[model samples]
Target: MSKQVVFHIGGWSSCGFYSKASNVLASLSILFPSRLKVVDHKYGSRDEYRSWLIGTSGSGFRDTFGISKASNQTSSPFAWIESSDGGNSFVGGCDDTLAWCKDFCAPKEEGGEEKAVHVDDGHTKGHGYDYDLVVIGGGSGGMAASKEAAKFGAKVAVLDFVKPSPAGSTWGLGGTCVNVGCIPKKLMHNAALIGEILSSDTEPFGFTAPQALEKGHSWEKMREAVQNHIRGLNFNYRVTLREKEVTYLNKLGKFVDAHTLSLTDKKGKVSQITSSRFIIATGGRPSPLNCEGGELAISSDDIFSLEQNPGKTLCVGASYIALECAGFLAGIGVDTEVAVRSILLRGFDREIADKIGAHMEDHGVKFRKGVVPAKLEKNGEGKIEVTFSDGTKDVYDTVFAAIGRSADTGKLGVENINLKVNERNGKIPTKFEQTSVPNVYAIGDVMEGCPELTPVAIQAGRHLARRLFDGSTTPMDYKNICTTVFTPMEFGTVGYNEEDAKEKFGCGSYEVYHSSFNPLEWSLSEHRGKHPAFAKVIVNKDTDAVLGIHYLGPHAGEVTQGFGVAMKKGVTYNDLLDTVGIHPTSAEVLTDLTVSKSSGKSADAKGC
Candidate 1:
């Protein structure tokens, strides 16, 4: 009797997991006369493909392959692939695993160098699955997991619905963070700042900008440039996936049954696929606010595609997104207004948030506090009319809804798999991102635990892959996870805030050491008063342990990253003081701050 075999094909890539997968497939093909085929799934189609693969049940091949479901799954090493054009090719996954298996396999078309090698190992004893383990999702985590498992002689396959990272995209192969989120966003932010400095303050520095300033930092050009760079990343990622021999599938995957997933393409075709183990790093989308007339508002996704700044724009919410976009608009001379309820940035020092607000207002942005839109509608001219709770109204050309974002777990069919979710947001719960379902797990933004920062997501995904497939099961440590808001004067923080520490310790006696100064860059410039730097170190009075480090100034993001590490390592206030300060740098203020014998210590007469 002919046995039906299931392959967990993911996007094209030639890296870690992909390489191991190739070896597993080659060994399996030698063990059984089966032809491995690749499948593609596109968008704008009907139901995705349905494979013969089971969603929840094991196959007769599982016992023969000697594979069993993980009994105590917590966290595991994993990587996955992603591709466009329905799996015609793939890219991005795990570069490390592919590097490890570089010498083992050659491309099928570049064959004739080595004949198929047979394996005499015990790996060929699973019953339900013709192969032992079938890994799903071809993102960085998925690819890494599958490849490592394969190296250990476990059968693995990765699946992805989107296009793989461009060729040689080592980081981009992982997903959005490398492709669209962190890197690109920072680059754009930097470019916008440059535009501001050149246009706004060139004269004060005895340098004159070009006769005619450019309009609003050419959003279309930046978008096109970033997209091209992303395409290159996609290419590099694909090459890595393919070289590793991980099966590439370009289709949207959803739970068809417990152990199986159904993949659909844009053309409505479908394939049923199954895996003994799975990892979900689908990430999150910007949350939507159900404000009246909010239909006219745009989310972060829309902001990415903008070609030009709107004539008049209003940014709603108080998260980093709102502050950053508002800063950009104001910097580029757009008529921008920030409308927020309560104080902005709930996690930062209240004083710092207020200063940032004042800085932005001074830079030409209009701030309206304690008021939000009761309803949003377009007037006869198609302009947005925002009616506030106080019955006052204002019109604008655009409104950005930056309230917040939740995990993108709705279509994941978590309910079908008995995955436990947090009661507050229906988000899948995990100590290290392991869901209730034994074989399935989640990380990154999709998994609810840590702050939703891009680096954190990438780190989580990378660590997950290592533990599951590479025999390293280290849990994520978020004790001092550093984060920043990309406003003009950047704000960054790590570790516990004063209120949290006080509550946890049952004492509100922590010492707050802070310093404020005018940065040297503004020394010779007339804009000295326009930009000020601030730093705060919250220390435990009893232990002198640095509980938190927060900063509002230039290069705050870069500076706070290192500070976060110190805080995580239980660095004390003396450790901060002993560290050699960078000469004449804004960050030096952090280490240079003198702790006061009392609370709320003031700086020198110059505020430095």
Candidate 2:
């Protein structure tokens, strides 16, 4: 009685014991062989499925369309047709199947041409929401997820706003990585590296003594160049959203309820909006120093864009942020010092962390152990007078509080929705990025236990959007992620550190293969390359699989990125030995790892 019918995804029946919808269609097909149509689900045309009946039971529609009930979205792909207003007659649900057949047999003038109305899903106009998805924070994760959902023909919006730091430092749209975090940090690190290279006595490399660098480098000039590049990235993120047709809201959002958000613009304007789904990628901010006159200190948030030179600076913290800043400051001849309350790089491999500390120390970054700044105040010379926890005192032109960062979820109103957040760090706990509330999700540093890295956030966000909209079954893999610490020596690591490996595999279960090699790049250079590069590989003794890899050398980021890819295959120590090595590369050390730390023989290399 109809032209044709297709079931793209058959719904479940008898608790998934049988494909009930497929049986229903088959029985009907026998009665009307010429009128009914059925095709393999794989062969189903992409565009034609929109008009076809998505055969499903009450709960079946959810699986049929890959829409989870927790999302609270209509459990049908043709939901727009069912909700269409002031339109032609519509048929929905399995009960209406026979009724539609009867209508298809009737005359055209009688309004029975088997016609189906077409509607766009790009905007949830007819659906019950101001937007399909609203993302809080315009950082790497939020922006990546928003653009991906929009690409799948879903309406998406991103909301972001920056609160000025204690020192009145503010930035643009691309969030921490592009603004004050990775981008600026890397640029400044490179600038310091270049200065170190130029000021070096490079007689072996055929470079003459450089008298031009006799005048110390200009911190203002480098800061300006870094800021200019960051500003461009910020503008590009905004333009990307516009090009993708995703709404860009320069407002801060707080939850009013499960689906409602109270939005506040920069000018103190307030409004309310609703969305079917929410993804929080708010990230974190530098914690303010909590001591007397602590406000006098700047943080990584303000250091990249500092107006004046940070002369004779004291970096107060042992975290990577503190070390990186200290490294660069010392490299550029700023006479930098570091004050530590505890161990450096607390969560990293202890051995690697110790080497980095020693390397920085040799490079002129002073360290004051077991002490934190108890008080910071301006002295008569305008330098900050800092009182240590040990009752000692010091003076410095600038004090940088690289203490740590806190997730910016305090005012996010997650409590209103009963979303349990990590009270100490403000990180939201999630399963596959899904929060306690079904329709809400969390990604990036804001999510509890996820790596607080930009690339990790971007990968998680993109994967999350695919699962939400593209019927993808892939979940974000949080394990074995490669990361780097941009200290002066540069440390790159992936998978478990040695301590964690021992804890996971137990003593005598995992053996450590390590080497201390002098790179050809540094073998003859006495001016810059003072420290020999180190490498370590943690292997499961039983399985021979590489449990972890760590590298300390130049371009650690570049060397580690390839390991990240090879790691996906579960590469074993034998597999590494089976492959040939690339000559004179820092990464090749991983493939040639033969000296076990347990052997007690020195892991040092004499030749390249």
Candidate 3:
């Protein structure tokens, strides 16, 4: 007797109609003859048939039907199906059964499964894009966002490319902080400190090395060591991206549309890719002086990688970058001079800023205050001839410009979208890191009104990724961020300055407690009595809560970090007094502060 098989195209369900399956079965029947075997298996759903075909087998139906055995078997229950016509068939597992059936029934010209339509309610299931998220620029902000989005199972990619400076200075991955800004700058600062210690702090401890002062420092050795450490960080960043399964592309990206980006590599080869979301974190670069022959002046980007020693250098501008460069240069035995446009550290607390400037000046750094460069000319002696606006002139072996930095958003093609960017400065105006475009966002120094520090960018980027993928709604808090300036005497501060605090809480509404003491280490140096370490705490008179804390001394960053946490927790003046003091430490001076500015008392620390 010839066996007959009634096979459903999809799976058969007793309660549901299978009209499409019936049509497909009718067509199959016309193509086959009586030799076909038909069996009526009442599989309730597609999952049931899939389980029977591929799952562990002990089914009596396999024995009753006496169907041909599978040609191959292994650890998996599913194996190749053998056909009598010398053809082989393969069935997918349960999760792919619906897709397999759709492909089997549809015509080849009609494509496979139908495209899924998604409703845009701020999120779409299975949204169609080349990637779930694409971040432009491999800086601190972009890298943080990429890694964070990947944690939520997002298909993330980051494209970063560094444009060489006019001085031909270019670095690898990890952006400004690792390459040219914080990492290298701090290393150089430490080098200067070591030089100071060797020159002055060795005698009083009874270890007499009189030749140490004359032996001096090696600029080449310091440069090589700092650069080597920076290069290692670049390699580690690449390794981290791979470990996190984030795709990294070394290509410059420009916006083609809201969802598309045009990428260009070093070879000038161009391509395009699309993503459901994009983040801009290109950061910033040092700006050039707006004067003739200004290109001859190197900015902060080239300072750390200079070939030879920067002898008799002249640093222009009164920004932190200017003071930092000059301070290190002077400490390392180079003749350094700074030309200030106006005030030092423009946005910082003026009192602490002047003290830092005074400390540098006392340590052999010259200041040309209230002067701006008019023209820069290369003299016959191959020195930079800097002509001031007031008809004065000076020449130096190297001229360094630290006027300011401009946001790196020029090549981003942000104008192609509806995003609002500052036309003057190229900074994107963002509300909680979200730009005007719904699918695009900006973070880090590239966003207006955001702190230009690396930690700020890192936190903002991670928070943004969590919100986009993990359904989080918490926004980043930008207040009370502790920061340290690596001047000759480091200045660390958090929250409001004394001037701002007084203005905010009325002229006499806040109590300012301050003390000045000499560091213990300084007692062993010849320059002991020249400059004293200072500490100030501002308290709101009404609430007695600490509003601001400032320190200017050795290890200021370490000392202020602890107080920063206290200020964030709303620690009061009495609470600080209640805390026990650590013996003979600069930070202990805070616990002993007893003089307030309102009382007309001298705020000075005596013997230990």
Candidate 4:
């Protein structure tokens, strides 16, 4: 409650807008010494401010205020409000900033002294329930919603419990990204990349690796470090909840009724609690392999914390999980193979997925096509003996099942309230995450048809909280959701794929502009694999509207993010050409795309 609010005001020196905005903000900061402070950044020009922001806070600052280096319009200074709680809310450009500061100080500046962000006492009352908001599953979405609701003075409780995997793997809060999915996966993926650099990438750069490379990777050490980092994050989330005054219970919650939930601890002790509203964000677990001796294979839940190096790994399935695991395993000097019964990265752009598969093949990863694991059993040597559907068998020290993920709604007692769950994926069907029961909602992977992404879930949760507590009507936009598959050569994509675009716009309605280029970073490496990285943009010919953007190369996630914002704003193909590109970067290839896939012309890069 004693936390100070900071206004980071960025502007050009000597500009009238900056002077006026500074005066308004200065008045507020001076009046409310304990509550408000202004950090003034004056630059020689608008571009100087842009350069300063980028140099100071990098992408985070640029993204917060939508500071475009490309923008030439010097309309007004940009301002953002940062609370001591580390919550950031944009206050907008000069005009909006002055208006907001005026509103805050007007009450005291005129006659009445009032709090800046005063929440009505009516918003805090629990309406006769034990809590105002009871969030089940202490994952990212639930954590965010609970904390935001608490900001509105609403009482919130978050219950989270990790049921041990079949292999007994369990972790604390922050959900899949922190515990098992993105965090650990990226750590291992980067480790594999480093291993590749040490083994070969160093030669071209005229450097030798440490002698440890000769002995190969130590999976035990990597596992230890990654798990330790994850644990720290988990602890921090717990502390964060405490600091926000949001009650957190390390217990599993099941619906006792529409308004009540049964909390059961690991010891099987049970208690009942009630809330005026509930949000389900239990997330998902890796699906079981579902075959004879399938339990013998480990899931992603066990891979991160594995006690021993997974030697000669056979990753079964074609999901990103499967390919990523295989990529890292092979990169670290372990023999790795992926078994596929169908296409790779289903629901993603198939061309990009096939390219990823080929890139993996060019590396050390092998593929066993047209075969699913029919059986998994221990051989005489105590290794996993995997029998394929084709009756072929292979033995391995470990087997990983990355078939898919199933939502954790089965045990939540959704049936008790007649909440409909998509029987196929066990995901709840919701209208903007609201279930059939008006009081209950769902987010994250558990929501039917929702993008199964952590950030999406987090945004949905925070936006839902604003709607519920602050009376906002902004719905979560699900279109053009950007995603990346972190294989050896990562694939980042947003909007529709080629096939999907064709399906939506008819075959002749849309045009595909694609290019293949060797990233300058890879040009020096002699071992730059078989295929050059690729980029493609699908545009509607009728309106020149950019329908989709896809890229495969290094740091694909970083490259796709800015394009995602553009896609959200309905950026057109002509818009891409009009934008100047930062040269020699992989992202620039997108802006320079000229070859049409329909033209039957070579999409390969023209000579430099």
Candidate 5:
């Protein structure tokens, strides 16, 4: 007698996985060797099948056929585990079944099975390295990429340098963002911003104290505390990585072949690993300015370790980093001067960036616009003389070089592989985190597209994990990615800029809505100037659809995130109107704008 097997392509909500299984079964028939008949569940009603899978949300698959449980049976709360290998193996049902039974799984003594697997798109690929996945640079992208692939039953291994950062004695499993780069920097930025608020706002608000606000906090102590928090997170990340059963190599990894890697530990020991797929997320480092006497300048990495603040500082570059450092110095009563070759913060909203420059100047930051640093020379008096392209020179105590960062792909043997890196800016070329080689992927600053923000890196890493390991083949859409700067008053933006929209869609087709106001928090302050918040929306005049949203204010980053989500979901101006505003909140200003009623421009008088 031929054995008959029925394939049920029910609405299991596994996103067509059951249909995929049916296709797999059809393919398996030719290879099964044994004679078997397959039945389709076409005749069963959808309601009946759903009821079968979720009868009580408890015992969804109790022996409806009156079969008794074996004396030595392992009981799992899943709907059923109908293994092709019979009672020798067990496979849990759909995600709903797992969710239903998750909390009820019994103790080890009662012979209960382990918790059912989630089987999301992130776990589509089977675990292990015999499978096609290879993850390079065990930072955020690498760890997440490898772990997700491993969960999908794909063989995954991460090659990363476990070399400790000078910022901390040890490294975390999550990589740069969590360990040394963004996370630590952001924490310091937060602390510094608070210090600025106390200094700039407290006295004006009639909140006097015996001690000066600047003396109320120590930058060194804050740095140590922030470092401690980062170290703790690193430890927790290691524990989580171990629980996920990921293969982590404590060595420097480089591309050896299209699907192979060479890992070298600090001890000069080397090991080789191969995989069918690979990912490159090594990220980037601060670029060297290469000016004469450049060694006298300090990069962003040294800022956290500064034992004493520079009494007078000249910051080079109009980049966000440079502006930020200048702002911090100005806040702390330093004679700060920011010099830029041309426009400050190129690629940023020109008007807003200029206004910010004006604000900086108002707060005592001198702007040396359209000036090039020819060279730097340290005099005997411990003052640094910086000469400009026009043969002019002035002296300051310190110089900060904040030009930009470059992709860290060159030394990683990426050139040896099939990967084609773009020569324009020397970044690994990728289409939505995919590299030249099909198996190898790239994300973060190591590759290009979108702003080089930590959140962008995390998103790319997480999304790649879902697509490769969880069976989600969806590509990440970069549209409406929110971004911010941690300067005095935070700036946040999402979607197209006014110029970008006009360039892409023409100015006649769009309208702008903008507003600036002093926040309620500053009501009691003697500095009655507007709190320096602006909300601008670019919209298609015909459809009333919001093309972009830009905000400058406190918590701008957090507020813009929700707007980013709305833009991603294709939310329109009418949608904005329909949603009830959260009263007395800074975000409500986004909804309060009436484009047709006013000039749709900020009222604050422009000054520089």
Candidate 6:
């Protein structure tokens, strides 16, 4: 029996028809026999083509292709090819066309056999998995990956569950940054800044009111406002997932096998899903010190939601979290003290860290350096009595522990699949986010050696999705990432620090150009001598390329972000010098930097 084949070349614009139709027709001829009766229908526009393809144009070939009519001959099958009239003529007749098409469509994986090689949606004609991608942990990374995959027509699902903190603090959909970490921290930091402005800067700025002269900040009001904003963000994330057609479940996922997961919800209801691929982005949580009465001390997770103001607070550890909490506490008129086990910002440059510490000290925040908390005990007056390893003790109304964070990988069932994680820290080790198990991948803070930042995770996640669904091979670049510490004076940095550059390239291999300048906005304030803004540019002595950049001043984050782009482009000190300086701005210090460390000249800035 002869088969009816229809080639409807419709909607091909002038340019597209010439470029694509010849190759497509070549593939079609190779797949079918010459006995087939082939009919070609050409149309100029997409609307006209759609009408004919749907049989509204009264094209008889639509009936042959089984559009509205059925064929009595079960043995004969029909096929359709849609195209447009391009200027190019048909290149070959039947046999030559068949041979060329066969070779072109041959599977590269197998030896010249035509097989479906799916690239976009993870499904290949015949597959057994229920979903194309299943992402565990609906944090920033997981959500990004899920949404990106869905955009390519893949069936994606995300499972997320937030286990409460030790202090019973819990949050919703948008993960740590939105629920507890960055969002709340920045809001509280801004609140403290507002308090400082009202108490100190308002008078200098020529704005003053009787009520604005009050010394205290309303902790209750600030907490409520921040929490309300966080709640709205959480809801928006849910709405986004729904709009993207990515299934979101409030369930905890545990690996049952390479392609299977057992999901358990809050009420103990359990379900299972199987996918061709999986992503783990569970992220991390704050860790408390292991000491007596340590449970009494709260971590950052609980601080933002505190019911009342933390008065006379003692922050333990030298991590950025500790310094930030101490800075804001002091800024808000609270008596804040920091207890450091060793150096501040351990992996950061000592010079910059010391400057930050000195600035904090000048701002009324005290530091008890070189002391580790040996024990903590409650005093009779409901204060925390902390004992140091050096046999000294002090009391404070509240103690905050910001020692470090641990990745949330304990309950992920990595052991079931022999997925290796760091023995010391529960961080999943992966190469390009692919775990030891072929189908399993990891991203975000849970991955070993990955940066514990939100944007880093989001970028990695989106990149991974593109690699899987869009046939992209570019990996996430982790170098020269700019980060900001929201201390009272703020610290923003990109690329390597001075010490790191020296260690990597040998001492005296680089030249450091630095300046101490007063931000124009600070002219009216008392921060001139005590908290002068500083900028440092580290350049390779041999190449003259800018290796690193650091800034300390108001809105340091805003200033450093621009320099970060320049550093990524390998902007050199000469390039910076050639760039025009924006007058009266702290960031322009980079362009105007003149004093080198070797010069031994004073780097302090004078009046404009």
Please, what's the RMSD in Å of model 6?
16.2
Clashes of each: 112, 0, 6, 0, 25, 3
Query: What are the per-residue Cα lDDT tens digits for candidate 3 across 1-608?
Result: 33443332334454233433343345555654463322233466656754554445644323233343532321121322335665544432223333333333322222122332212324454778899999998998999999999999999999999999999999999989989998998888888898888777877788776775667778888899989999999999999999999999999999999999999999999999999999999999998989988998999989999978988898999988898889899989999999998899987888899999889999999999889889999999999899998889989999999999889999998889867888888899876688888788888999998988999999999988998888776777777789999998999999889778867768888888998889887976768667899998888785577888889999998999998888766677888999999997889988878889889888777887
Off by over 4 Å in 5: 1-132, 162-173, 203-206, 210-217, 381-383, 528-531, 595-608
Q: Write the per-residue lDDT of candidate 2 for residues 495-580, one digit (tens) a residue.
A: 88999987876899888999998777776678544578999888878556787889999899999988877676677778888878
Q: What are the lDDT scores of the predictions, listed in order?
A: 0.64, 0.79, 0.80, 0.84, 0.66, 0.78
RMSD to the true structure for each prediction, in A, is 22.3, 16.4, 21.5, 14.5, 14.2, 16.2
Instruction: Judging by TM-score, tell me the better candidate of 1 and 6.
Output: 6
| 1-608: candidate 1 lDDT, tens digit per residue | 32333333332233344445555544645654453322222112111111111213434222222223422211111222222323311222335324322322211113222322212222224436433445444555555555555565555556655532211122335455555466666777787678767876688778878654744356667778876786687676667666665566666778765577877865879878766566776666666657777778886666655656567988998877888888877776678898888778887667778888888888788988898888999899989899987788899998888887766566666677777776556466765656677667776666776667666755765565565555565666655788888887788988766667667655755777877787777666676565568788888775577877888888888889888877766787888889999878888888877855264556532743
RMSD of 5: 14.2
**Model 5: lDDT of residue 415:** 71
Better of 4 and 6 by lDDT: 4
Kindly provide the TM-score of model 4 when superposed on the true structure, using C-alpha atoms: 0.79
Model 3 regions lying over 4 Å from their true place: 1-123, 210-212
Q: Which pairs, if any, clash in model 6?
A: 8-81, 8-82, 9-83
Candidate with better lDDT, 2 vs 3:
3
TM-score of candidate 6 relative to the true fold: 0.79
lDDT of 5 by residue, 1-608 (tens): 33434322333333354445444444545544363233433214445554554465534533442223422222221223244655322233344333322222211112122221222212223434454666777677667667766676666566667543333344556666776566766676676566666765777667774375636556567667876887788677667667777766777888777756787888999888766667787776666667788777776756655666666888888888888777766765678898888887787676677767777787778888788788898999988888987788999887878888777776677678757876656688776577667666787778876467776766777778777656565665555678887666778888778778879778687877777766666545655363467787887775566888888877888899999998876666777878888866778878866644146444542321
Winner by TM-score between candidate 6 and candidate 4 = 4
| TM of each candidate vs. truth | 0.72, 0.79, 0.79, 0.79, 0.73, 0.79
lDDT for position 250 in model 6: 96
Of 2 and 4, the candidate ahead on lDDT is: 4
**Could you tell me which 10 consecutive residues in candidate 1 have the lowest summed lDDT?**
45-54
TM-score of 1: 0.72
**TM-score of candidate 3 on Cα atoms, chains taken together:** 0.79
lDDT of 4 at 456: 94
Instruction: List residue ranges in candidate 1 displaced over 4 A.
Output: 1-158, 162-180, 212-216, 243-245, 595-601, 604-608
Q: What is the per-residue lDDT of model 4 for residues 106-194, given as tens digits with 9 covering 90 to 100?
A: 21112112222212223335379899999998888889999998998888999999999999999988888889899899999999889
